[model samples]
Target chain A: MSLKSNVIGALILAGCASLYGCAGQHSEAALQQAGADFQKVKEDSNVLRIAPKDVIRAGESLARADRLSTYWGSGSDVVHYAYLSQRYSEIAREHTTQALNEERAAKLELERQRLQLALRESKLLSVQQQGKWLEEQIVALATTQTDRGLVMTLGDVLFDTGEAELKNSANRVVLKIVQFLQLNPKRVVRIEGYTDSTGGKQENLKLSRDRAQAVADVLMDLGIEDKRIQVEGYGDEYPVDANASERGRAQNRRVEIVFSDEKGQLGAAR
Target chain B: MAVLALAGCASDPAPNEQFRLTEQALEQAKAVGATADEVPEMKLAEGKFNRAKGNMADQSFKNARMRAEQAELDARLAEAKVLTQKSEEQVNVLNTRIVRLRKQLGDAQ
Candidate 1:
C-alpha cells in the first residue's frame, strides 16, 4: 500500500477511537459555540441577554412526545426534526405569552396613572371655586380629625337666639354644606349641638336637639340619604369654652360637624 | 470546502438581519412608553428564539435532515407588538378627539 493511503487509514482509525473515547466531549464544544453565539446575540441589542439554555428538560414532559413523533426507518429523521422543532416552538410560545402579559400589565398601569391625573385635575378645578367660598366663610376656623371623622367649624350663624330655627343668612352656608355633602356622598356624619352656660341645662338640651335636627333635616332635604346621619345635642354640657363673658358665650353656642369617613368599596370596579 | 462554504453562506448577513429585525420590534415597544431599557426585552426574547432556531438548525445538520424550519415565534411576537402599538395609538387619538369635542361643545353651550 502507498504511504499516503496507510497514513490516512491510521488517522481515520485513530480519529474514530478518540471520538468514541470522548463521547460527551462534543457537548463541551457545543457549549462553547453556544456561548460565543450568545455573546453575538447580546451585542445585537444593548438589552442584557440570557444565554438560551438546553431547556427541553425545563419544558413540560418532552420524552413521551419525542418518542411518539419519532419513528424508525423511513422518514424517521424527518419525524425527529419535526418533534424537536415543535418543542422549541412551544418553549418560545411560553416566553412570548409571558412577554405579552407583561406588556399588557404595563399598558394598564400607564392608563391608570393617566386617568388618576385627569381626575385630580378636575377635582382641583372644582375645589378652586369652593376654596374661594371657604376663604370667606372660614374665618377663625380650625380643623381636626377624630375616630369619628373630619370636623369643620361652622360658625354660630346657623341658629337664632335661644331657638334652633335656621337663620335667614345661614341659608348660604347651609346650601354650601349641602352641596359639599352631595359631592361627597360616600361619607357619614354626626351633628353635635351646644349652647352657652347662661341657658338652663334642660332648655339648652332642647335647643341643641332642635338645632341638630334642623341641620340634619337640611342635609336630608339636600339629597343626602337619611341613614347616613347621627344627631346628638350636648347643649351646655359640651361647652367648648367658659361662658364667663360674651366672647366665650359666642364661642360656646355653636354646632360641631363631625364626619365618619371610611374608604369603603361600595361599588369600586375595575 | 463544504465546511468553508457553509460558514460563509450567511455569516455577516445574519447579524445585520437580526439587528434590523430587533430594531423593528423595539420601535413597536417604544410606542407603548417602554423605557429604553425595557424596550430591549423584546430583543432578549428574540435572542432566545434565535437560539432555539440555531439548535433546530444544528439538529438538522447533524442528522442528515431534510429541511430546517425557521422558528417564527420571534417574528410573531414582534408583529403582535406592532399591532398592539397601532391599536393603542388609535385609542389615544380617539380619546383626544373626544376630549376636544367635549370642550368645544361646552364652550358653545
Candidate 2:
C-alpha cells in the first residue's frame, strides 16, 4: 500500500512539472519579445529624448520579468511583467512620434508666417509699381472736367445687360480707382449710375442703383473706406447721347465716377 | 514551498490605487478622441481594464495590478496616437497653406 501511494505521488509530480514546463516556455517567449521591444526604443535617439520616463519604466518592467523568469513556478508573473514592459515600450514609441510631429508643426508654422510676410511685401511692391502707371491711365480716362468734378465714365459693357453685377473685365479699372483713392486718401468719389430708356422707370431706377452699389462694394472690398464713396442712380436721366440708336443708347447707359479735388471737397450731387 | 507561496499571496496588498490610475488613463484616452472601435490600443486597454476589475472582485490582487498597469500604458498609447494624428493634420494644413502661398508668390513674380 505504501509503494502504491509513492507511485501515485510521483505521477502527480511529473504532471505538475510538465505543466510548469509549458508555462515556462510561453513566458520565455513573452520575455524575449518584451526585451526586443525595449532594446529598440532604448536605441532610438528620438524615443530616448522625448520619452525617457517611459523607456526607464519599460526597462524596469523587463528587469522584473527577467528576474521572475528564474523562479520555478513564477511563469505567470514573468509573462505579466513582460507584457507590461512591451506596453511601456510601445507607449514610448507613440510618445516619440507625437513629439516629433509637434516639432515639425512648429517649424512649419514659422515657415508659414515668413511666407505670409513675404507675400504681403511683394504685393505692396507690385501695387507701388502699378500706382505710377495707373496714374497716367486715370489722367487719360478723365474725359471731362465738367461742373460735376473730374468725371470718368465706366461704360455699360462693364456690366451684364440689365444686371447689377460688374464683370471681371472691369478689374483693371477698379484696381486703378482703388490705387488712385489709396494715393489720395483725403479725396472722395461719387458714383452715379444711368441706364438707357428701355425698362420701366422704377426698374431702371433699381437696376441703376444696384449697379452703382456694386461698384461701391468692390471698392470697399479692396480696402477703401465706405465713408469715402457716395452712390447715386439717375434712371433714364443724365444721358450723354440720344436714345435713338444702339450706339447712342450704349453711350447713354453708363456709370460715371466723379472724384473730389485734392482737398477732399466733393461736388454737390445732381 | 507551498507555505512560501501563501506568504507571497498574503503580502500582496489590493491594487486599489492601480485600478484608479488605470481608470483615469482610460478616461483621458477617451477625452482625446480615442475610441475602442477606432484605436486598437484603446480596445486592448478597455478589455484589460474590465478583466482587471474582475480580478479585483475575485481578490486576485497580483493579476489585477499587472493587468491594470498594462491597461494604463495601453490607454496612454492610444491617447498619444490620437494626438499624433491631430498634429499630423496640423502639419498637412500648414503644408497646404504653404503651397498656396508659394503659388501666389509665383503668380505675383
Give candidate 1's error at residue B33 in angstroms.
53
Candidate 1, residues B33-90, lDDT tens digits: the string is 5442443435544455456446445542322111122222333344444545555665
lDDT of 2 at B18: 92
Question: Candidate 1 docking: what grade?
Answer: incorrect
lDDT of 2 at A201: 99
lDDT of 2 by residue, A104-184 (tens): 999999999999999999998988787667767887898988987788999999999989999999999998899899987
**Per-residue lDDT over B15-50 for candidate 2, one digit per residue giving the tens place of the 0 to 100 score:** 989989989999999999999999999999999999
lDDT of candidate 1 over A168-233, digit per residue (tens) = 777776676666565555656677788888857899888987888888888888787888777888
DockQ score of the complex predicted as candidate 2: 0.57
Candidate 1, superposed: residue stretches over 4 Å from native: A1-142, A145-148, A262-270, B1-109
Q: Let me know the TM-score candidate 1 reaches against the reference structure.
A: 0.36
DockQ of each: 0.03, 0.57
Interface RMSD for candidates 1 onward, in order: 9.0, 2.0
